[model samples]
Target: MPVGHFPLQDKIVVITGGGSGICFSFAQLALTSGARGILICDLQLTPAAQDLINQTPDEVHFMKCDVTDWNDLEAIPPKVEEAFGKGQVGDVWIAGAGVFEPKWSSFIYDEEKEGGYKAMRINAEHPIKLTRIAMRSAISVNKPCAVLIVSSGAGITGQYAAALYCATKHAVVGFTKSMGQADIDENCKIVCILPGMVSTPLWTGRSDAVASQFSYTDEVCITPEDVAQGMKEMIEEEKYPGGSLMSIAKGKLRNVLESKLAFANDGSEIYKQFESKCYAPIREIWNGERGTKLS
Candidate 1:
C-alpha cells in the first residue's frame, strides 16, 4: 500500500456533485496532482461545463445525474470505464452530492414531504447506495480504491430548525464510520470528512426569507477551497488509514477524536496504552468469542 503518497497520477476520478463547491475545488486540485481525467456527475451540469470548459485547463468531463436516483448511480461505473478506456474501476470517488431544505427542514412543517424525503435521500441514502456499488465493483475486480464521504459538522452537532438535515447528516456519520471499518476488513480506504460552516450554494437564498439562524461572520465560515485542500491532504497522506475521521473548520484541519479517547485519563502514558488496558480485551471478547455465540 502506498501510504502518505500522492497516487492520483494518471487515474480516473469520479465525483458526485463535482460541478461546484467543495467537490469542484477538489477536482481542480486532483487534476493539478496528476489525475488523468475527472468525470463530474450532477443534476446541474451546464453551468459547470460553461464555466469550467473555457475557464479551467483541467480535463473535465460532465455528466448529468440525479444522485437520488439509483439508476443514475448504477450506470456511473461503466460510463467512467468507457470514458477512461480502462477496466480499472474508479480510482477514487467523492460522495459529495447533497441537498438542503429551506423552510421545510422543520419537523413542525405541515406539507413538506417532498423536501424531507429529497433531502434525506440526497444527503444520506444517495452516497450510501453509490458507495456500496463502488465497493462491490472494486472488490469484484480486486482493485484498490478510495472513497471520500463529505459529511458535515451537523453530523456531530444538531441544527436548530433543520431536524431532517441533522438526522440525515447523523446517519451519514454513522454509515461512514461503519464503511470505514469495512474498508479495513477489505483493502480499500474510506475517508470521512466533517466540514464546519462553509461558503457554498447550500446557503444561497432570497433576502426576503425569514433570515437564516445559522449565519455567522465571514470569518466563521470556512472557504470551500480550504475544505477541498483539507480533503486533498487527507487523500495524499498515507497516515490517514481507513476509518479516518477528520474535521475541517476555521481554516484548520484536525482529527475527530474517537469516543474512546475521551475516556482516557490525562497522564504520562500514551492514550493507546489506556485504550489497550480499558477496551482492548472486551473488544476482543465481543468481536471474537462473545459475538460468535449464537442462539
Candidate 2:
C-alpha cells in the first residue's frame, strides 16, 4: 500500500448519497478508521444508514440534500460546521450520489419526461457543483481536502441502452481529469473512481429500473463493500494523486489512464489543425479581442 497524503483519522467527512450503496459502505468504514465526524447527506435515509447514525449518533450525522438543487448543495458547508463545529472544513468530500438512467428521466423517453434529464443533473452536474463548493470551502480555511467523485464503468465504456447514464459518467471523468491538470497541492486534491457493475441498490434492488440490464453472472458483480474498500484505499493507503481515475472491478483496483480510458485522442496532424482552428476564435475572444458576454 502506497502512503496516502490524506488520512481519515480525526478528520471530518461529508458524503452525498451516503444513505446507501458505495457511499454508505464508505461511511461505515470511515468510522471504524477513527474519523472524527461524518455528515451523510442524501434525499432520505436507508434503514442501515439510520441504524449506523443511531449507533454512533455523536460521530455520524445525516442531512437531507437534493444534489440537483443548488440550494441544497450551498447549505452543506453550514451543515458541516453545525455538525462538527466551526472551522471544520471537511477533509473528504465524496460526491457519491448518482442515478443509473431510469425510465422517468431517460434519454430514450426524453419527449415524455418533463424538465431536463434528472440523471444528468444528479450524476454530472451535482459532482461538478459539489467539487466547487468543497474545494473552495477547504481552501478558504487553508486545509487539506480531497474530493472523491463516484463515476461508473458506463462513464468510460458506452452502453447503448443507457446513453444518458453513460454520458453523465463520462462527464465526470472528463471533469475530474481536467481538474487534475491544475496545481492541486495549493488548493485541494480531487480523484474519481469508476466502479464496474457493483451489487448495490443501483443494480440489485428490484425497484430499480436498471436492475434487469445487469443480468450478468454473479462472478462479474462486485459488492458495494468492494468499491468502498477501494475508495478507502484510494483515500488512505493508495494515495492516488490529484485528478487520478481509479477503477474498481472484479475485486481489484486499477488506475485508469486518462488518455486511453476516458478520451483516446488520436494525435493526428489533421485533428490538431481542426482543434486549433476551433479554438482560435474562442482564444481570441478570451483575450478580449471579441466581447466576452454570452448574453
Candidate 3:
C-alpha cells in the first residue's frame, strides 16, 4: 500500500502524547489520509496538540492523560470509542511521549538531586504500561491496529553520556520483541523507530551534543515532519514487521534485521565480547522465565 492508500478515509485514529513533536505532525498526516476522527491525548492539555487538530477536517478531540498512570491510560479506549461511534479503532499511534531531562544524565554525578526514578518511570515503565493496555484493547476488537513507538538512535547504539535514556530505549526495543508474537493474531503490529535527531522543541539546547555523538552534519539532522512521514509510510505499507527496528534519516529507511549483522569485527572487539559474556544470563532469564509469563 502507498502512503495514503490504506483506506484512512473515515477511519478512527488515536494518538497518545500527540500534543507536539512528530506525533502532532502525524495527526496532520492522518487527517490528510482521510481519517474521520482523531483523539489526541497528552500529559497535559497543550495548545499545540489542539491547534493541529483544529486544522483537520475531521472531528478532533483532546484529553489530558498521563501515560504512566494505568487509570489514565485505561480511560482512553472508552473515550475513543464514544467519539468514534464505539467499536474497533482503525489506527492507533503512540507518539507523544519522550524524555530528555538533565537529571536522567548518568553524567550527572549528583544522584540525590538527579531523580533517576523519574526517567525510568516516564521513559520506560510508562510506555510499557501504555503498550500493554493498548494491545489488550485493540486485540479485543480484532481489527488491524498498528503501534508506532518513537525511539531514538541512541537506543539502538548506546551513547556515552545518555546512559539512562539509552537503557530505557533498549527496554522498549526488547518489549517490542517480546510482545510481537502475542499481538500477531490481532493484526496489532508494533514498530520501533530509531530516528536521528530531529528539529523540535526538545532540541532547543540539546542538538550540539547529540550531533557530536551521532556524527551528524548540520544538514543531516531531520525534522519532525520527516519522522511523521516515515511513520505514515510504515503504517500504510506494513512492510516492516513487529520486531523490526527502522532507522529513518535523510529520507532513507533501513531495516536493521535485513541489512545489518548483529556483530562486526572491530579493533576493540569490546562490544562483541560484552554481548557474548553479558547476554547469556539475561537472555536465559528472559527466555526461561519472562517469556513464559508474557506468552
Candidate 4:
C-alpha cells in the first residue's frame, strides 16, 4: 500500500532472449541504472545487438543459448556468478524467450512424418523452465529475486488461425499469475506483460518489413522501447501488486481485469450464480475422480 520502489543498482541481471527487441531495451536501461553485471542469453547474437554489446559496461557479457534446452539454460547461472562472484548471482531475471507462430504451419504440424509444437516449446515451456531455474538458484543463494514473463495480447485474447502461439502466451500469463499467488510471502515477485502489436522483427518475419501488421498501422504500433519502458515503470514504481497483470498498447498501459470475478461487486450474488454456471462443466470434468472418466 505504501509508495514502493526497488533499485537495480549494482545487481547482476540475467535476461533470456536479450539479443534484440524489448529485451535489448531492458538491457540498455539496466546498465544505465548501474547494474553490476548482465548476461544476455539468446539463441545467438544478432547484428542489432552488436551496438548493445559494445556499450555494455565492463562486466556485462553475452552468450549463445538455446532456451528450450534444459542443459543449455541451466548452465547460465553458474557462468554468471563465476564471472560476477559466487552467491552474488543477483536477483533480477527477465524470461523473454519466445517465438512467433509458423508462417505455414498450424498449431500441430506434421512435417516429414514428425508432428511438432514449436511455438509451445519456445514461447511457453522455455519461460517456465528458465523461471524455475532462476528462482531455484536465487533461493539457494539466499537472494531476493523478481521475474518478468513476456507475453502478448494473445495471452489475454486468443488469436484466430494462430492457436499455438495464442495458447502458449496464455499459458505464460496463467503460470505467472499462479506462481505470484502461490508464493505471496516469498522473496521473488513474478510479473507479466501483455503487449499488443509492437514494432519489432517478430511481427514481420523480415527486417525490411514495417512494424505494423493486421490492420494496425505503423503509427499505432507500439515500439519495443515503449513496452520496455512501461514494464520498467510497472515494476520499479510498484504501482501494481504482485500477481497483477497489465495490458500494454500504443505507448500506454493499464491494469487488465481479464476476469469478471476480479471486479464483481461485494455481495453480488448474480455474479456468483453466473460463475457457477460458467464453471459447472469444468468442475464436472476436472474435480478428483470425475476428471478420470472419458465419457
Candidate 5:
C-alpha cells in the first residue's frame, strides 16, 4: 500500500541540476508526493524534464542556470519568490547538480589553468554557495527549511584515478556535517546523500572516463529512482537528523558513521581495478612526460 501521508505535501522545492538524472528523478517523486511548487534550475532541461513541465504546467518551472556562476545563483532567490510568491522560501532545497570531472573541466587537465579546478567549483563550491544562499533565504523569512546536499561514495572512500573528484565529494561531506550547527538557531536542517554506483549520465555517459574504470555494471549499480527514494526518506524520516550522511547502495539505505565511512569499499575488487586504470597517464602528466590535453 502506498503511504498516505507525504511529508512534502504543500512544500515548495528547488533543485539545481534537475535535468536528466537523480535530480530529475527526485523532482518527479517530489511532485507525486504533493509538492505545491517546484523550480528546476539547469543549463537546459532534458526531454524528460521538459515533459514533466508539460504534464504539470502549474506546479513546476524551469530556469536555465549554470551552477558555477555566482550571478546565476544569485538570481535564484528572486526566481523562487516569483514562482511561488513573495516572502516564500523553498521548504526543500537540493544542491543536486554536479559533474564527474570531464576532460574539459578536469583536475588532471585544468588544475592550474587560470582559475581552479572546474570539478571542484561545480561539485564542491557550488553546493557551499547555494547552501549559504538557501540558509539566508530561509532565515530572512524565519522559516524552517531542509537542504539536501548530493554527495557520493567517492566523498568517503578515496579513488586514486579521480583524486580531485574524491576531494570535491569529501569537501561537501565535511561542509554538511559542519552546517548541522547552523540548525541550532535557524531550523535550517541540512543532510547529505552518499549514493554508491548510481547509474546516471554523469558517471555512465563517458565510456572512457575514470568512473567507467570501476565495475558499475547494471548489476552493481542502483537506479536514480532508488537514490531519490533515499533522498525522500532522509527529508521525511525523523531518525535522520541534521548533518546525517545516508548511504544508498544496491537499493539499501544506511546511515553512514563518518568515522567508519572509510571502510565502505576497503577490500572490493572494483576499487582495486579503479586504482589501477589511469596510473600511467596521470603519472605522465605529473612528471611532464606528456603534454596536457585540455580539450
Candidate 6:
C-alpha cells in the first residue's frame, strides 16, 4: 500500500508564540508538510516569525499578540476567519509562549521583578485562553480541528527552584485533559506535548537550572529541529488525541517506572482480568452488542 501524504495540505493553521524557538521550528515543519496558510502570533511581532514565512512555500502571516491578553486572543478568530474567507481554523498550535524563570526560597515566593507573571501568563493562562478561542472558531466553521499545547516535563514532575514554571506547566496539562473531554466532537482533538529542554533562544542568557537538572556537559541541549520533528510526527500520526505525548532524549523514551512495576500476582492474571472484564466488555458494547452469551 502507498503511504499517506502530508495531511495538513491547505489547512489554515494558527500558532501563537510563533516568532521564535520551538514554535518557529514547528512552523517550518508545517510548511514542508503542505500547510496552506499559517498565522504566526507572538507577544511582539518579531521579524523571526516573518523570516520563517519568507522561507516557506506556504502562505504565512505574522501577528503581534500577547497570549495573556484575552482581547488579543478573542480578536484572532475573526482575523483568521477573514484571511481564510471562512470563520474557522482547521488546526491551531499553541507553541509560541513559555517561561523558565527560577523560583525564590518558598512556593509562595513571588518574583514580579524577575518576570514571574510573564511566565504564568504565557505558559499557562495564554494556552487555555487560546484553546477556547480556537475551539469556538473550529466549531463555528464546522470543521475538524486540532489544538497542540506545548508543555514541559517540569509540568509533569515538579522541579526544585522552579515552582512557578512547574505550576504553569501542570496547569497546561490539566487544561488539555479537561478540555479534551468536554470538546470531544468527531472533529476536534486536544493534545499536550511535554518537551524536555530543547535548544532555543528562549534558554539563551538564562540561568543554568535546565543544564544542571538534565546533566548537560555544556550549556547546549536538544535542538529546535529535534522538537520540530517530534511535533510533526505527532500531528501526522493522529493516534494520540487527548493525550500527553512526551519527547525525551534518544534512548530514553520509555516510561521505565511503569515498565518495571511488579504486581502482587503474575502479569498474565492481570491481563486476563483486564481483557475479560474491561476491554472485551467495552468492545462488545461499542459494537452494539448487549452482552456476550456463552452457549
Displacement of the residue 270 alpha carbon in candidate 4, Å: 23
Model 6 TM-score is 0.73
Model 2 over residues 137-198: C-alpha lDDT tens digits?
A: 76566565778899987778988888898999999998888765222333467788999987
Give the best candidate by TM-score.
Answer: 2
Q: Which tens-of-lDDT digit does each residue in 125-172 have in candidate 5?
A: 999999878876765665667889999988889977778889999999
**Shift in Å, residue 185, candidate 4:** 2.6
lDDT of 6: 0.64
* Over 4 Å off, model 3: 1-7, 45-48, 55-58, 88-90, 104-116, 205-218, 251-295
Candidate 1 lDDT tens digits, 1-295: 3233547778678899888788888888888888888888987753654577456534667778898789999989878777666565687889999866545444545456664466778889988887777666666666667788898888888866767778888887787665554444445677778898777776653343433556645667888788887787666678776567788888566666352223434655686587567666644532442212121
Show where candidate 4 strays beyond 4 Å. Answer: 1-4, 108-115, 204-213, 256-295
- Model 4 over residues 73-187: C-alpha lDDT tens digits? 8898777867776656656788887876554334544332236565677889888888777666655554556777898889988666567788998898888776653223345
RMSD, one per candidate, in order: 7.3, 6.8, 8.4, 8.5, 14.1, 9.0
In angstroms, how far off is 206's CA in candidate 2?
Answer: 3.6
Worst 10 residues of 6 by lDDT: 256-265
lDDT against the true structure, each candidate:
0.72, 0.80, 0.65, 0.70, 0.80, 0.64
Which residue pairs does candidate 4 place in steric collision? none
The ten-residue window of minimal lDDT in model 2 covers 286-295
TM-score of every model? Answer: 0.79, 0.83, 0.74, 0.79, 0.82, 0.73
* Per-residue alpha-carbon lDDT of candidate 6 for residues 1-295, written as tens digits (9 for 90 to 100): 1112226666777888778888888887787778888888886544766666677633787777877778888888777766666544546555557767645322455746754476778788888888766655655544556777888777679877677778888897777665443233334566677777667766664565654655654234567777776666655554455443554544453221111112222558776685466445534432342122221
lDDT of 5: 0.80
What are the clash counts of all predictions, listed in order?
A: 2, 0, 1, 0, 0, 1
Please give the range of 10 consecutive residues that has the lowest summed lDDT in model 3. Answer: 286-295
| lDDT by residue for model 3 (200-234), tens | 65665464465455454547678888888777766
What is the TM-score ranking, best to worst?
2, 5, 1, 4, 3, 6
